[model samples]
Target: MASICLGRQPILDRNHNLVAFELLFRQEETEETAHVTSDLSASANVIVNAYGKFGIHNVLGHQRGFINADPDLILSDIISLLPSKHIVLEVKESASITLEFLQRCKELKQKGYQFALDNIVAINSQVELLLPLVSVVKIDVLALTRNQLTQLVNQLNHWPVLLLALKVENQEQEAHCRQLGFQMFQGYYFAKPEVMSIKRADPGKIPLLKLLALVMQDNDQNSDIDEIEKEFKHQPGLSYNLLRMVNSGSDGLPLKINSIKQAVQLMGRKQLQKWIQLLLYTSSQSADSLSDEITQTAVTRGKLMELIARAERPHDKNHHERAYMVGILSLLDQLLGIEMQQIVNKLGISDDMNQALLNRQGRLGQALKLIEAKEKGETASIPSLLSELDFLSLNELSDIETQVRGWTDHTDATVN
Candidate 1:
């Protein structure tokens, strides 16, 4: 099998909720051109890799996935391999839209497949023809003027197809699209932090941070456990969640834990620390209500970094934990709506871990850079980063990513 690199970009609804992700992939050798000898073969490989190798639920969770489809792939039987109800077949505007193509798309639609017209610049004959067939029409807002966009949206109003603003880069674009009645949006806008007058951590999260500090203390004395249990006593919600999580058997605890003290003893400080870190994300909000994509992104990064550290160091457990911590903490600034230095100062992490989170300067930092690059679809930078690691190969890294996806998916389910 060819070494294929996979990437996903989130698509948000009008309310800025994560609704789906646009799944992207390219063969290792064809990174630049993204040219495949056979479109059908490449598409088949993507489906097999995403559904078979990566697992659809792992990659998509409960959300749908937008997959690009050329006419050949759209018309072929291979497309049926995907869960039709959970995938949106994104047909590019460049496809040869003939009567046969229309018929094939209609046939698929009848079978529960959804379609989105990709990179639509103007409402021409092709756009007009496909409007009724596709559930969505992705407008290339970057390519059009404000007047052109308004005109296009007006023309598109004839059909009930959802208007999706593509390549929206900032809040300005998102706001404009929402004002223009675009129902869905795809871009980096959500990842960008909103400007706020005061940047402070949420009050509810403060106790979780304190508990994390107590759990992560380096002292081996019994008093460390006492301090942790004391903190948990003050926060009944946190204690209940801890016991509930352990009882859920997601932590692989041999027996049920009834109290915070028992949890600390059986799970150990390291595992306890891990649970606190994750709990920080879900403590105040219900699992289902924690809809921010950044939380899932943080968890995925942490697990990937942890797995990579395990692969490299093998027996160095501390290094693995630090890697996971750094990966997750790297995004705390955006998550908490505060500065990275502020969060670091509150946690009082080691200098090395601090550097990894703030500056991306250490071994953990390098791992984070690789993960970020993969997330942003910067496939070109992957080779150099892999070379810098020196202990991992592209195939190995891909496998690690596959593992992380599945692990994070399971973690999300357990938390939910």
Candidate 2:
């Protein structure tokens, strides 16, 4: 149940009211620059994860969703899975503008599914063929020069399609698009992605490494407390943060927590382990990347996998814990810039954990893969993956993802 990192950009009307969100998508093996894929299944997966997995309302709230739809999806019955009332099917520019495509749009239009032309830069015969069928034309404002923008606007003036200016990065662009009669606006001009560079893992992680080892080796003995307390004493910063977080409004303790020992006693082994796993991400030096976003992703992934395991093995609490470990640890290589085996050995985790992390073997490993596939939008493997896990369906996966995301958001809000 690693959380699918669903990206969304708001689409605003001329009056700057939020009308809808364009759900950004990426699949496994795709380029970083590619937001939405041309693959029909990729689009379907996005829909499934968004409306199905993440809960359409959780991601979209009261507004609508504008999703990318390639030619195949536009013509196929799969697009029907998305309720027409909540989504505007955006046709990718590469889709051949043909009589059949138009016919399909026309048919869907009859059924109340709206359509838009995505990332249009110019007007031509093909564009003309589609202009009547689509309700909106998304123009990349950054892609068009001043003269071209004016010309394109004038060319489309008589057409019925509403113009949406995309990639609006400043007030000037916003004003220009407005003056040019663009009916909608989108881009970083509204909100920017907080940029962060991956830094080398902090040396501080060594203490966490010790704590992880101690927690992993717990034999339900009093000795576990001494070993863990010793590790905490060595890392004053970690102890302070842990105590502060546990007492802070986020943990919502009925009694104020004042000591590491108290926090450990109250949090217990399982809760404390998850807390430490989260600490591994924050222990990094970077203020933004590892501290906030990366840690959130790992936490979400871990929780999702844990939920999936619980669904599959209701009584096996140990399996659920292991699944969470596999998820958060899966990102160890990227976080630590070290080999998975090296990190696994250093942490003294079980062989099963090692196999799941390094080789993607066993039930926990499969759970990890299922989460990864969801994140990557690899729909092809989703059915087979679900079948192996007691026939969990796409809708079930969506619920799991949505629940984990909500939990992660709540935890992050508490910690922050």
Candidate 3:
């Protein structure tokens, strides 16, 4: 099957709750923004991969998904295939506001499908006509100044449609949008850390860090397992969760594990290491917390990095393991609210992994850079990064991404 690369960005409500995701069609392998020659074909691919290959529940869970819709898609029968209740079709701003376009939107609205006017910079006759039909209006916040944004918000206040601030890049922008009465927001602001020098890693997480370091160490003596088991004993909750995860394995364990040692033995060091990394996200907080999205993002990154490494090295298990570690650890600073350098220092990871995590250097570092670029929608830089890793083509990266997304979605569902 041809690989599909889909990029997703979280959309938060006024309360900063993850209420939806803006699913973007990415064409990282090609020179054009979309591999398909036409926008209709591009939209078709996104809908198929999201709702078919990945499944809606895996992609959006219980939250709604905001998908881009050009005029062609908006007026087509294919749009009806999307579940009306779970989807919010975003009408592209560049779409011509003809009478037929407006009529089609009204038809979709009557069928229980919601529409959002995408990247609205100013209120005009076209926007006014569609306001009543759309349930949401996504304003291009980055395109306007503070005064312009406030003025636009006030103008939009005349309508019943909810205002969504698009391209929000920082907390300050989000606050401004909230003050301006934007009900929904889409951006990378949530993932970016507000670093504080005084912030330290949670004391409870220190042991998990040590356990991670020990597992990644070169020493394979039985003493290593004893030390790991000892650490888990010190944290009974971690031990119990480990056992639970093993028992609940999709491929059922051949033997029941009665002790931490047994669980460790059954899972082996590699799998145990991954579980401990995952526990770093779940053990400290509820699954419904705001950090849930961040945890999911980290897991996705880790899996993508691992797949890329597998494709590149093919035979180097250690390199693949480190790639996964780099991807997961890349976001630790955001999760822990501490400087990444400090976390790396504490983990005592190898120098290559350290460079990858802290500076985005080395082979693994370039892979991390590619993932970051993909997340930020910097598709222009992707081709060059792919060039650096000549062994793996863009099609391979797309395939790897599709596989990683599926794995991460499954892992998130299982972990929760």
Candidate 4:
């Protein structure tokens, strides 16, 4: 998944716990514009312009969105183009702290638009001029240690400007930042970031991929099962796994599955491929011979949320697919040594699915993160997050383990 300007961890008090995150959003691609004007005046398009639609839409309903802008945009009439009060105008680091930029910032602040100074460091820079003008001063965490951060916090401690620590990477860093009195946190340490190179292959996949390639061929919209498996006469192991999955009681098949034909006839295309993928994980690579239970946790969570959406709202969605994708991909960064998008494209996922995983752009991404937080047992913040999602509690979400446990069990059982 590509990192769209997705969501971020909220700025925390020195406690290293979440207070509320800086929510990132994707600019919806709509041809016709409403709140923003056709004329691009001051801000030369150095940064990708997010359509103020997310802000406007939030405005109509009273929500908040943060939009980053340059000094040029501040000087132009563009600040007026913002939809409503629910926006935080982030003054980019590249922008000058000129009298004009400061004056416009003061004007926006007067109009209820919060200003954030991006990548601020060393209170002495032009930041000294703009500090009194902005509400939040965001510092990149990578550049500071506990000592330097402590010094900065002590210095900025008296100022009303909030100290936001952005891009925190691990528990130690998080804890250190908390000790240093940072008010916000953001980074990739929460979910496993996908790695580009997993040194070993799933030993089970070599054989399994070959079999799956067989099954995938029949999936051609035109071909029948018998016609597809017609050429493979010597595949016994493939014959057995399909039979086990078909007879695995979950399918409720009337008779036992002995051949690929029986599996094709009874289980159908969709279910069979799922079993094959799960079984393949039985090999040593990702599963580490562990059960699919770990991955299933994510899948079940995704599916349950999807079900909640469907019953509550009524929509035809690949909620289950999205769920499985999240569960499996949570470990992707480990296997691939890269970001989620690198592997997400290898799978069949929808735009919303991609949005949630890579960019944290959709409803599902919010749901997934909520589940993750709950699982970690961050007692106080989860409910507040739930409040944002407009959901009651973990009562419904608690059912996720039931959905995903079996997959984990399959791989675990094999290892044992």
Candidate 2: residue 53 lDDT (0-100): 37
Candidate 4, residues 1-416, lDDT tens digits: the string is: 11112222344456545444343322222212123221121121111112211112222123344555655345433355343444566775432345545676787777777888777666776667777877887887789766777777788777798777777778887787777766666566543211111122222434544545555442554365665355324455445434443443231222444666766666666555555554443332223423334433433454455554553455555554455446445554443344666645544456776777787656777766776675677768777776767854566555543432322223233211
Order of the predicted models by lDDT, top scorer first:
3, 1, 2, 4
Task: List the candidates' TM-scores in order.
Answer: 0.44, 0.45, 0.45, 0.37
State the lDDT of candidate 1 residue by residue for 234-331, as single tens digits.
87655654554344323223245566788767656755665565445643232223334666567678778898999999999999888887877887
Q: What are the clashing pairs of model 3?
A: none
Q: Which candidate is the best by TM-score?
A: 2
Off by over 4 Å in 1: 1-4, 28-38, 191-416
Candidate 2 error regions (>4 Å): 27-38, 193-416
For model 3, residues 1-416, the per-residue Cα lDDT tens digits are: 23335657788888889899877665443322333334444555566546434445556777888888876566544564566877899875442556666777888889889988888899887677778888899999989999999999889888888999998998899989998888988876764211111111232577888888778777765888888889889876566556554543323222456788877887778667755664466433322233445655776787788889998889999898789878878888877777988888778899999988878898999999999998888999999999987777888888776554432323224311
Report the Cα RMSD per candidate: 17.9, 14.7, 17.7, 24.0
**How high is the lDDT of residue 406 in model 1?**
29
* Top model number, lDDT: 3
TM-score head-to-head 1 vs 4, winner: 1
TM-score of 4: 0.37
